[model samples]
Target: MESKEEHYSHDHIMESIRNLSENDAKTFLNLIYALLRDNTLPSEQLVSHVLSVYEKKIPRVVKTRQNK
Candidate 1:
Protein backbone atom coordinates (compact mmCIF):
# COMPACT_ATOMS: atom_id res chain seq x y z
CA MET A 1 0.00 0.00 0.00
CA GLU A 2 1.10 3.53 -0.69
CA SER A 3 1.95 5.77 2.25
CA LYS A 4 -0.08 8.95 2.81
CA GLU A 5 2.96 11.14 2.20
CA GLU A 6 3.73 9.36 -1.05
CA HIS A 7 0.13 9.72 -2.22
CA TYR A 8 0.16 13.39 -1.38
CA SER A 9 3.43 13.87 -3.22
CA HIS A 10 2.03 12.26 -6.36
CA ASP A 11 -1.15 14.28 -6.06
CA HIS A 12 0.82 17.50 -5.77
CA ILE A 13 2.91 16.63 -8.78
CA MET A 14 -0.20 15.84 -10.82
CA GLU A 15 -1.85 19.10 -9.73
CA SER A 16 1.22 21.02 -10.88
CA ILE A 17 1.12 19.21 -14.21
CA ARG A 18 -2.58 19.92 -14.64
CA ASN A 19 -1.96 23.62 -14.08
CA LEU A 20 0.55 23.91 -16.93
CA SER A 21 -0.53 25.90 -19.99
CA GLU A 22 -1.30 23.77 -23.06
CA ASN A 23 1.83 24.94 -24.87
CA ASP A 24 3.98 24.34 -21.81
CA ALA A 25 2.60 20.83 -21.42
CA LYS A 26 3.38 20.06 -25.05
CA THR A 27 6.88 21.44 -24.74
CA PHE A 28 7.51 19.47 -21.57
CA LEU A 29 6.35 16.23 -23.18
CA ASN A 30 8.43 16.98 -26.26
CA LEU A 31 11.53 17.48 -24.14
CA ILE A 32 10.92 14.18 -22.40
CA TYR A 33 10.53 12.49 -25.78
CA ALA A 34 13.83 13.99 -26.92
CA LEU A 35 15.60 12.59 -23.88
CA LEU A 36 14.14 9.17 -24.48
CA ARG A 37 15.20 9.32 -28.12
CA ASP A 38 18.79 10.10 -27.19
CA ASN A 39 19.19 6.96 -25.06
CA THR A 40 21.40 4.10 -26.36
CA LEU A 41 18.61 1.50 -26.05
CA PRO A 42 16.37 0.71 -28.98
CA SER A 43 12.97 2.36 -28.68
CA GLU A 44 10.96 -0.80 -29.37
CA GLN A 45 12.80 -2.78 -26.67
CA LEU A 46 12.22 -0.02 -24.16
CA VAL A 47 8.52 0.00 -25.03
CA SER A 48 8.30 -3.77 -24.66
CA HIS A 49 9.96 -3.64 -21.25
CA VAL A 50 7.64 -0.91 -20.06
CA LEU A 51 4.53 -2.77 -21.20
CA SER A 52 5.68 -6.02 -19.60
CA VAL A 53 6.41 -4.38 -16.27
CA TYR A 54 3.37 -2.13 -16.02
CA GLU A 55 0.81 -4.38 -17.64
CA LYS A 56 2.12 -7.63 -16.12
CA LYS A 57 1.91 -9.30 -19.52
CA ILE A 58 4.40 -10.16 -22.20
CA PRO A 59 4.33 -8.19 -25.43
CA ARG A 60 3.01 -10.08 -28.43
CA VAL A 61 6.13 -9.40 -30.47
CA VAL A 62 9.24 -8.43 -28.55
CA LYS A 63 12.44 -7.79 -30.42
CA THR A 64 15.15 -10.44 -30.01
CA ARG A 65 18.83 -9.77 -29.40
CA GLN A 66 19.66 -11.69 -32.57
CA ASN A 67 17.52 -9.29 -34.55
CA LYS A 68 19.72 -6.39 -33.60
Candidate 2:
Protein backbone atom coordinates (compact mmCIF):
# COMPACT_ATOMS: atom_id res chain seq x y z
CA MET A 1 0.00 0.00 0.00
CA GLU A 2 1.25 3.49 -0.88
CA SER A 3 1.48 6.23 1.65
CA LYS A 4 -0.86 9.14 1.05
CA GLU A 5 1.85 11.43 -0.30
CA GLU A 6 3.12 8.98 -2.94
CA HIS A 7 -0.02 9.13 -5.02
CA TYR A 8 -0.80 11.87 -7.56
CA SER A 9 -4.06 12.57 -9.33
CA HIS A 10 -4.22 12.96 -13.12
CA ASP A 11 -5.01 16.63 -12.71
CA HIS A 12 -1.85 17.11 -10.70
CA ILE A 13 0.31 15.55 -13.39
CA MET A 14 -1.54 17.43 -16.11
CA GLU A 15 -0.84 20.63 -14.27
CA SER A 16 2.86 19.82 -14.29
CA ILE A 17 2.67 19.12 -17.98
CA ARG A 18 0.89 22.36 -18.70
CA ASN A 19 4.14 24.33 -18.99
CA LEU A 20 6.02 21.70 -20.99
CA SER A 21 6.47 21.63 -24.73
CA GLU A 22 4.60 18.78 -26.39
CA ASN A 23 7.80 17.04 -27.43
CA ASP A 24 9.36 17.35 -23.98
CA ALA A 25 6.16 16.22 -22.34
CA LYS A 26 5.93 13.15 -24.54
CA THR A 27 9.51 12.22 -23.72
CA PHE A 28 8.84 12.72 -20.02
CA LEU A 29 5.82 10.44 -20.26
CA ASN A 30 7.77 7.74 -22.08
CA LEU A 31 10.41 7.81 -19.35
CA ILE A 32 7.69 7.52 -16.74
CA TYR A 33 6.35 4.34 -18.31
CA ALA A 34 9.86 2.97 -18.68
CA LEU A 35 10.52 3.51 -14.98
CA LEU A 36 7.23 1.84 -14.08
CA ARG A 37 8.14 -1.22 -16.14
CA ASP A 38 11.86 -1.40 -15.24
CA ASN A 39 11.77 -0.74 -11.52
CA THR A 40 10.28 -3.07 -8.92
CA LEU A 41 8.42 -0.33 -7.06
CA PRO A 42 4.67 -0.04 -7.46
CA SER A 43 3.60 2.12 -10.39
CA GLU A 44 2.46 4.91 -8.09
CA GLN A 45 5.43 4.79 -5.76
CA LEU A 46 7.86 4.28 -8.59
CA VAL A 47 6.72 7.50 -10.20
CA SER A 48 7.40 9.38 -7.02
CA HIS A 49 10.79 7.77 -6.56
CA VAL A 50 11.72 8.35 -10.18
CA LEU A 51 11.00 12.05 -9.83
CA SER A 52 12.96 12.18 -6.62
CA VAL A 53 15.89 10.31 -8.07
CA TYR A 54 15.97 12.41 -11.20
CA GLU A 55 15.83 15.62 -9.23
CA LYS A 56 18.61 14.49 -6.96
CA LYS A 57 21.09 11.82 -8.09
CA ILE A 58 20.55 11.22 -11.78
CA PRO A 59 23.81 12.84 -12.80
CA ARG A 60 25.74 10.96 -10.17
CA VAL A 61 24.03 7.73 -11.19
CA VAL A 62 24.99 8.26 -14.80
CA LYS A 63 28.60 9.06 -14.00
CA THR A 64 31.09 6.28 -14.33
CA ARG A 65 30.86 3.67 -11.59
CA GLN A 66 34.65 3.22 -11.79
CA ASN A 67 35.08 6.67 -10.27
CA LYS A 68 33.34 5.58 -7.07
Candidate 3:
Protein backbone atom coordinates (compact mmCIF):
# COMPACT_ATOMS: atom_id res chain seq x y z
CA MET A 1 0.00 0.00 0.00
CA GLU A 2 1.20 3.46 -0.83
CA SER A 3 1.54 5.97 2.01
CA LYS A 4 -0.55 9.15 1.80
CA GLU A 5 2.54 11.22 1.09
CA GLU A 6 3.66 8.92 -1.66
CA HIS A 7 0.23 8.96 -3.28
CA TYR A 8 0.09 12.72 -3.15
CA SER A 9 3.56 13.01 -4.62
CA HIS A 10 2.65 10.72 -7.48
CA ASP A 11 -0.52 12.70 -8.20
CA HIS A 12 1.41 15.97 -8.13
CA ILE A 13 4.00 14.65 -10.57
CA MET A 14 1.33 13.42 -12.96
CA GLU A 15 -0.51 16.75 -12.79
CA SER A 16 2.69 18.63 -13.52
CA ILE A 17 3.43 16.44 -16.51
CA ARG A 18 -0.09 16.89 -17.84
CA ASN A 19 0.26 20.65 -17.70
CA LEU A 20 3.53 20.73 -19.65
CA SER A 21 3.55 22.08 -23.22
CA GLU A 22 4.01 19.39 -25.88
CA ASN A 23 7.59 20.42 -26.60
CA ASP A 24 8.47 20.51 -22.93
CA ALA A 25 6.86 17.13 -22.39
CA LYS A 26 8.89 15.70 -25.26
CA THR A 27 12.04 17.16 -23.77
CA PHE A 28 11.17 15.72 -20.36
CA LEU A 29 10.64 12.29 -21.87
CA ASN A 30 13.96 12.56 -23.68
CA LEU A 31 15.65 13.38 -20.38
CA ILE A 32 14.09 10.31 -18.78
CA TYR A 33 15.30 8.18 -21.69
CA ALA A 34 18.77 9.63 -21.41
CA LEU A 35 18.89 8.92 -17.69
CA LEU A 36 17.89 5.32 -18.23
CA ARG A 37 20.31 4.97 -21.11
CA ASP A 38 23.12 6.41 -19.04
CA ASN A 39 22.39 3.80 -16.39
CA THR A 40 23.01 1.15 -19.12
CA LEU A 41 19.48 -0.24 -19.14
CA PRO A 42 18.52 -1.68 -22.52
CA SER A 43 15.62 -0.04 -24.38
CA GLU A 44 13.80 -3.37 -24.65
CA GLN A 45 13.99 -3.86 -20.89
CA LEU A 46 12.71 -0.35 -20.30
CA VAL A 47 9.74 -0.91 -22.55
CA SER A 48 8.95 -4.20 -20.85
CA HIS A 49 9.23 -2.68 -17.39
CA VAL A 50 7.02 0.29 -18.27
CA LEU A 51 4.36 -1.96 -19.82
CA SER A 52 4.26 -4.19 -16.75
CA VAL A 53 3.86 -1.22 -14.40
CA TYR A 54 1.23 0.38 -16.61
CA GLU A 55 -0.74 -2.88 -16.76
CA LYS A 56 -0.98 -2.87 -12.96
CA LYS A 57 -2.56 0.57 -12.99
CA ILE A 58 -6.29 1.01 -13.70
CA PRO A 59 -7.26 0.14 -17.26
CA ARG A 60 -8.90 2.90 -19.25
CA VAL A 61 -9.56 3.86 -22.85
CA VAL A 62 -6.70 6.06 -23.98
CA LYS A 63 -7.98 8.59 -26.48
CA THR A 64 -5.48 10.16 -28.88
CA ARG A 65 -6.16 13.49 -30.48
CA GLN A 66 -5.90 13.84 -34.24
CA ASN A 67 -3.51 16.61 -35.19
CA LYS A 68 -5.19 19.08 -37.47
Candidate 4:
Protein backbone atom coordinates (compact mmCIF):
# COMPACT_ATOMS: atom_id res chain seq x y z
CA MET A 1 0.00 0.00 0.00
CA GLU A 2 1.16 3.52 -0.77
CA SER A 3 1.83 5.77 2.20
CA LYS A 4 0.40 9.28 2.43
CA GLU A 5 3.70 10.81 1.34
CA GLU A 6 3.95 8.51 -1.66
CA HIS A 7 0.42 9.32 -2.75
CA TYR A 8 1.03 13.04 -2.35
CA SER A 9 4.25 12.80 -4.36
CA HIS A 10 2.51 10.88 -7.14
CA ASP A 11 -0.31 13.42 -7.31
CA HIS A 12 2.13 16.31 -7.30
CA ILE A 13 4.13 14.81 -10.13
CA MET A 14 0.99 14.21 -12.19
CA GLU A 15 -0.20 17.78 -11.64
CA SER A 16 3.20 19.11 -12.63
CA ILE A 17 3.08 17.08 -15.84
CA ARG A 18 -0.43 18.31 -16.55
CA ASN A 19 0.75 21.92 -16.19
CA LEU A 20 3.72 21.55 -18.55
CA SER A 21 3.71 23.44 -21.86
CA GLU A 22 2.84 21.48 -25.01
CA ASN A 23 6.46 21.25 -26.18
CA ASP A 24 7.68 20.42 -22.74
CA ALA A 25 5.06 17.72 -22.38
CA LYS A 26 6.11 16.22 -25.71
CA THR A 27 9.73 16.18 -24.59
CA PHE A 28 8.72 14.56 -21.34
CA LEU A 29 6.65 11.96 -23.16
CA ASN A 30 9.58 11.15 -25.43
CA LEU A 31 11.81 10.68 -22.41
CA ILE A 32 9.25 8.27 -20.96
CA TYR A 33 9.15 6.43 -24.27
CA ALA A 34 12.91 6.01 -24.20
CA LEU A 35 12.76 4.72 -20.66
CA LEU A 36 10.16 2.10 -21.59
CA ARG A 37 11.69 1.11 -24.93
CA ASP A 38 13.62 -1.84 -23.49
CA ASN A 39 10.48 -3.92 -22.99
CA THR A 40 7.48 -3.71 -25.31
CA LEU A 41 5.19 -1.77 -23.03
CA PRO A 42 1.60 -1.73 -24.28
CA SER A 43 0.87 1.39 -22.26
CA GLU A 44 3.52 3.39 -24.10
CA GLN A 45 2.05 2.45 -27.46
CA LEU A 46 -1.47 3.08 -26.22
CA VAL A 47 -0.66 6.56 -24.93
CA SER A 48 1.16 7.48 -28.14
CA HIS A 49 -1.73 6.27 -30.28
CA VAL A 50 -4.31 8.04 -28.13
CA LEU A 51 -2.40 11.31 -28.26
CA SER A 52 -1.97 11.05 -32.04
CA VAL A 53 -5.69 10.48 -32.48
CA TYR A 54 -6.60 13.40 -30.26
CA GLU A 55 -4.04 15.61 -31.98
CA LYS A 56 -5.69 14.90 -35.33
CA LYS A 57 -9.17 15.42 -33.93
CA ILE A 58 -8.56 18.60 -31.94
CA PRO A 59 -7.42 21.79 -33.61
CA ARG A 60 -4.74 23.87 -31.96
CA VAL A 61 -5.83 27.12 -30.31
CA VAL A 62 -3.71 30.21 -30.86
CA LYS A 63 -3.85 32.75 -28.05
CA THR A 64 -3.58 36.35 -29.19
CA ARG A 65 -4.27 39.59 -27.37
CA GLN A 66 -6.36 42.27 -29.03
CA ASN A 67 -4.83 45.75 -29.32
CA LYS A 68 -6.25 48.17 -26.78
Query: Per-candidate TM vs. native?
Result: 0.46, 0.42, 0.42, 0.39
Clashing pairs in 4: none
C-alpha lDDT of all candidate models, in order: 0.44, 0.54, 0.45, 0.44
lDDT of 3 by residue, 26-51 (tens): 65567556666665668788775554
Tens digits of per-residue lDDT for model 1 on 1-68?
A: 43322323444445555555577557666755655676666888767544332222111111121234
Residue pairs with backbone atoms closer than 3 Å in model 2 (clashes): none
lDDT of 2 by residue, 1-68 (tens): 43434534456444444545577557666776788778987768877777754442332322323245
- The sequence of per-residue lDDT tens digits that candidate 4 reaches over residues 1-68 is 32322322444444554555687567656755665565465877767654542342121211111111
Off by over 4 Å in 4: 1-8, 38-68
* TM-score order of candidates, top first: 1, 3, 2, 4
Better of 1 and 3 by TM-score: 1
The root-mean-square deviation over C-alpha atoms between each candidate and the true structure, in angstroms, is 15.9, 10.6, 10.6, 12.3
Model 2 ranges off by over 4 Å: 1-16, 42-47, 51-68
Candidate number with greatest lDDT: 2
Which of 3 and 4 is the better model by TM-score?
Answer: 3
- Select the stronger candidate by lDDT from 3 and 4: 3
Range of the 10 consecutive residues with the lowest summed lDDT in candidate 4: 59-68
Candidate 3 runs further than 4 Å off: 1-8, 40-68
